[model samples]
Target chain A: MDIAYFPGCSLHAMAHEYDTSTRLVCQRLGINLYEVPDWNCCGATAAHSLDHHLSVGLSSRNLALVKDMNLKQMTTPCAGCFNRLKTASVELKQNDDLTAEIEKLAGISLTGAKEVEVAHTLQVIMEAVGMEGIKEQVIKPLNGMKLAAYSGCLITRPRAIAQFDDPEQPVALDHLLQALGAQPVHWSHKAECCGGGFAASDTDIVVDLGGQVLEAARQAGAEAIVAACPMCQTNLDTRQRAIEDERGIKYNLPIVYFTQLMGLAFSYSPRQMGLNRLLTSPTTLLRSRGLS
Target chain B: MSADFYKPMRLNEIDSSLQEEIKKVCDINVELCMECGKCTGGCSNAHIFDYTPRKIVQLVKLGAEKTLLSMDALWTCVSCQLCVDRCPSQINIPHIMDYIREKAHRQGVKTRRINVELFHDLMLNSIRKTGRVAEAPLMLNFNLRSRQYMKDAVLGGRMFLKGKLSPFSPVVKDIDHVRRLFKKIADNREG
Candidate 1:
């Protein structure tokens, strides 16, 4: 199960924990992740917001690199990057004019680029390592830790671009948590927005929307929130205290990456999964469940 | 409140160029929208948007270019795609938002939320320089430029202690390729 990996910008810096856990879990699952060499940023919300051609061109450059790696599939841990790369790959394959334009703008030949498939890291794990396969490797079950599976936007969004899982009501993360012996609570804001790129530009939006997600997770009695996207994890974890201060309520729920939980279930240490990097600590919750 | 509220719009005089442009650029037909408020109902940021998703679509059909380009919704939209997914006609409001936003940016329309566009520009400048975004430096510059210097100072210190803030920025091996792509796109947009 060899696949090309694009950790994106956040994985290298803010979401380094996601990168660590993803690599560790993938290795344990016998999945070889060959990183796309010298990949550029996916342009994210910026490029797409300002210029559509630049957005497609940026991801097309990475797609071209994947073809050069001779890999048929690529996976990214960041949902934003996955969305941009997947959208580019889909558009490049479907629209000849787009392929030609992207080739001209990016200076990369898309001769066999149509063969390259883009998928989120969660999709890779679910497809390559099935529920039975994951359960077989769970040396340390979650001990019934209640978790809110926060798929966030971009992972299962726009339907046409992501092309995996339900956009409105995603359950892949919940199913994965169930395979790990964790109880995934039913929450309203599971697939809601966490103000994404607005975290830096406008803090109010994150405070408002992220507050809704945290409140929903807490109301559902989740011990912790599980996230697959770096932005969502960052927003929910970092801005939680601010949200609490604003709403006059306390939500001490830690936002953990799905990969981190998978690593824990696979008997990896908390340090190995970079669990301490989270702002809202999950140590207490994990300890209470006797799974730390 | 005003006489304009009771005045009927001259349907034949309404401009359709913006609608045509949207169809040409995004391949989304504004006319397909049945004025269902499902988009606004499920919108994550509709509460903050000056013009809701349904109204934005209506404005597109009405060819309200000035309103569409200058609305605060252009800056506040989270691009969650919930509106498009929930739309009976799949109008792609997010894409429409993007198209209008890009146009607004090009026209240099005054954004109601200036910091949002500023942050985006800063991120793009970082990419233009390093071929990748350096989160630590980018955030610092954003704080400095946006005059919100103390915005995340506490979080920064905590993250720094945890070794989350890397000082070194990542530069791609072949930087010229990225610069060339950026230059070409800018030139294309201008020409």
Candidate 2:
């Protein structure tokens, strides 16, 4: 199966490991990911916060590029990019005024833009490779390693835009973990916000909210937290020490991308999955489980 | 309840222009709200917000545009969309928050959380310049502009060691197309 992929800005830089693992895992799953050529930034929180039209227009340009690619579907690894692109696709199809304005701004005729469907990479994996299919490819079972499936906010949010999984209680990640032979622990902060896009702007918000997420996962007896979004992984992993320092509690939980875990289950080496890139190293935890 | 809760509010005297504007722009009817605090209850940042989602809707109904635009909630809202999804009426509080925040930005209203706005501007500036955001340089510029050079310094070192921080910024081949969109938005806002 071939799908247009938009790695977004984070995947190229701060979340390079996510990009590497996503490509490797998708290759193993027999999914061909054709990157959308010359795709621009999705304008994320900044565009949406200041100018709604610009936000839609920025994403519309990318959607137009996907339309040009002649691909019916486009998928992104970043939840923030997925939200923006999906929102733009939904809005342009429904609101003719927006479609017209975006065409004028983007200087491209979005004739078949509505035909392009935007989905998160997780949705792609779940739909293209079913639970049974994933179970069949598990060369190395997770050895009952407990994990907290952290969906963050944008993956399955607002109910209308994402249009996949439950916004309140998302279980797709949990189900995927189960298929990988990992024990997905019941956690309260599964779909909670990780203070996204605020890690640079306001560090305190991430520390406060991310602290709660970490504490919830730790309380649920999760050996590690599996995240699908780069922002969530970055916030939870990088600021963990700060969160510990502020809350005066020890939480040495490593935040790993779900793709990384899938790669591990596919018998890929830790270095192949870029596991060493994680701030809170999962080496000790994985070694304990004998899965690494 | 506070004694102010019992104070009779003259419905005829209250200006509903803000609510009217929201409906006009986003088609979200704040009047459809039944005063259910479920939005605030599930809100991710309500504890940190000066005006919760429920209160922001009420402010719109009362035509408290000044307060709505200048409130710290405008800057602090995480846009998690929990409030909108949980609302029985499905009032898009995040959309309203975005609309009001944009208005505040256009008017140059003084935000208590200046760094938040500054970071946003820097990100936009990066996109406008290169058609894509370079995380490494963007973070550097944010730290420099916010005057906290030491912020995220340790994390930066770790990321650099992990080969995450790329020194070269990625630029789109068709940069003119992206800039035109930014210029058009600016022109529209001005006109």
Candidate 1: Cα lDDT at A63: 88
Q: What is the lDDT of residue B7 in candidate 2?
A: 68
For each candidate, report its DockQ versus the true two-chain complex: 0.84, 0.85
C-alpha lDDT score of every prediction, in listed order: 0.91, 0.92
Candidate 2 ranges with C-alpha deviation above 4 Å:
B1-8
Model 2: what TM-score for its first chain?
A: 0.99
C-alpha lDDT of candidate 1 relative to the true structure: 0.91
Q: lDDT per residue, candidate 1, B73-184, as tens digits?
A: 8999999989988999988888898889999999999986999999999999999899999999999999999898798899889889877888879999988999999999
lDDT of 2 at B86: 98
TM-scores, all models, native as reference: 0.98, 0.98
**lDDT of candidate 2 at residue B95, scale 0 to 100:** 96
Residue-wise C-alpha lDDT for candidate 1, range A144-166, written one tens digit per residue: 99999999999999998899999
Worst 10 residues of 1 chain A by lDDT: A106-115
Docking class of 1: high
Candidate 1's displacement at residue B11, Å, is 1.1
